[model samples]
Target: MIDKRCSDTELVSLYQTGNEAAFEMLLHRHKSRVYTAIYLIVKDRYEAEDLLQDTFIKAINTIKAGRYNEEGKFLPWVCRIAHNLAIDHFRKRKRYPEVTLEDGSQLFDSMRFAEESYEDKQMFRDTRSRMRDLIKELPDEQKQVLIMRHYLQMTFQEIAERTEVSINTALGRMRYALINLRKKMIKNNIAYDENFYPKRFDQVSIPRGQQGPDERD
Candidate 1:
């Protein structure tokens, strides 16, 4: 019998060596998180279920073909596959949902920029647009951390688990992401304002229950 406490790395290794039960264990352990990730994006239970199955099927095929190299970081790797599949699903349908802020602003989160004039708001919008472009210029690891934390609204601990890194590593990546973004902003002649963007990960507000009072790097 396979130990229920077996690590993901152990389960993956056993599965690679022809133990089908190990693969099943892996699926059982991670299925909920994977499904949730898909559901959050697709916002449809049936569609999330279908994509979840497709995700594991793709992973199974890759493992069978001896191409699985993710090793210890199994969950994050699988989550990324599911994320891509969900994105592709929307792309194929050509109907992407608009993420809105509390005040009905589209695409941008509920960040209150202290703008009092039409010109200021328009400048803020243009800055945000350029910021998105700058984000694309970040290194893949940094970009992934940034998107997962800011856009996905994931907690640091959750980000660490999904990215298969320590909390400090996740926090460090975010810090560097902000630094890099600020550098790009200066290079592009955009003003850097801490009130508009988080200059540090710790300054970003954590949801009430998502983080403890003592949680920090």
Candidate 2:
């Protein structure tokens, strides 16, 4: 019973005009990408689905309250809402499970061995598997920061605010994490290039004009 002719933005505008079916159309258009982003972070299909529903509900309320602003793309705005909601869910739970790529099908497999031959594929798989295991060996704080920075594409300042640490502290934890991961790779005789990871944490100089850590509080 959905109108296939209308675009997402048009559907959103209709919803704002009190057309209920238009909201359903918008939800149908964006649900997959929003769910995928949440699943990538939460790593649970059921949880991702639940979060996706909740996200849409929240978005509806936001629009109803006249708080929705048409920004970049409608999908990315939905994605940001889902991302923040997932983060809040984890914070409230106080313990989050490690995200696995096992459920991600061929898409996950392709990322690790996209450029290699059959022979190299198996080798890359083995190496990447071992590296993931070693990454798990890092301390929780370090692991969270690294995952947020690399996997979630969060900046150092974002990680600091999320983890309730100073930017310098977040940078320091990332530095130590890299050193530990590198040491593990070396010990296992793995030939990972240092450039593949965040290695310039030491070279990051805080700007002088920025407020000091003490001043912000």
Candidate 3:
């Protein structure tokens, strides 16, 4: 029997030596963390599951092709791939709903139980619902940019290429989207913890030679 507690480094080394069971063990250990991360960004349980499978398939191909270099943190590398895959998926689809529990009882339980306080759990649910409503109110362009940047974890440059906009344009749109969302939340009397929704939105900067958030200016 494979030791479930084998470190990522050990599993990766074994995989490089052609031990398929090591790869399986590695996948089992990080599957939930990876899937949850993707689901958080994509906000769709079914779509997240699909993307998770697709990510592992790609990883397998990369490994077979000798393209996977284990620099030690295997799970992080896998997660980066999964994150990019989720972003690509969203770019092709062009829209995403806000994160939700929906029929994903396992995911909900994982997130809720992970929270240390019952109040925190309730706040998470409420915040998710409010975010869903806010997303619907955004202009099409703003909404698309926000989804790609936040949910899909795509960098501004990646978003620019996918959306056919300049990097700067992508950044500006994200900034404006946050501003609009903040305004909407205030206007609608929605309460949330800023720590949970910090200015992480503003860190998205687009490249130059592109329009800013006011492109619709």
Per-residue lDDT tens digits for candidate 2, residues 53-160, read 898888888888988886525665676578677766665554523432222112121122223245433544676657765766777667667766754456798768
The model with the greatest lDDT is 1
Give all TM-scores, in the order shown: 0.49, 0.45, 0.49
How far out, in Å, is residue 187 in model 1? Answer: 42
Q: RMSD, each candidate, Å?
A: 14.8, 12.4, 11.7
Candidate 1, which ten residues in sequence have the lowest lDDT sum?
106-115
Task: Please list the residue runs of candidate 1 whose C-alpha ends up more than 4 Å from where it truly belongs after superposition.
Answer: 97-217
Q: Write the per-residue lDDT of candidate 1 for residues 58-122, one digit (tens) a residue.
A: 99998889898976777778876786676667656645335422223221111122123454335
Pairs in clash, predicted candidate 2: none
Span of ten consecutive residues with least summed lDDT in model 3: 104-113
User: lDDT tens digits, residues 1-217, model 3?
Assistant: 6676566777777887899999888787677667757765565567778989998888888877878886766665777688667656655654433332222112212221222345434545676766665765787667767765665556788768766778899899998999999999899888787578634311334566675873333
lDDT of each: 0.68, 0.65, 0.66
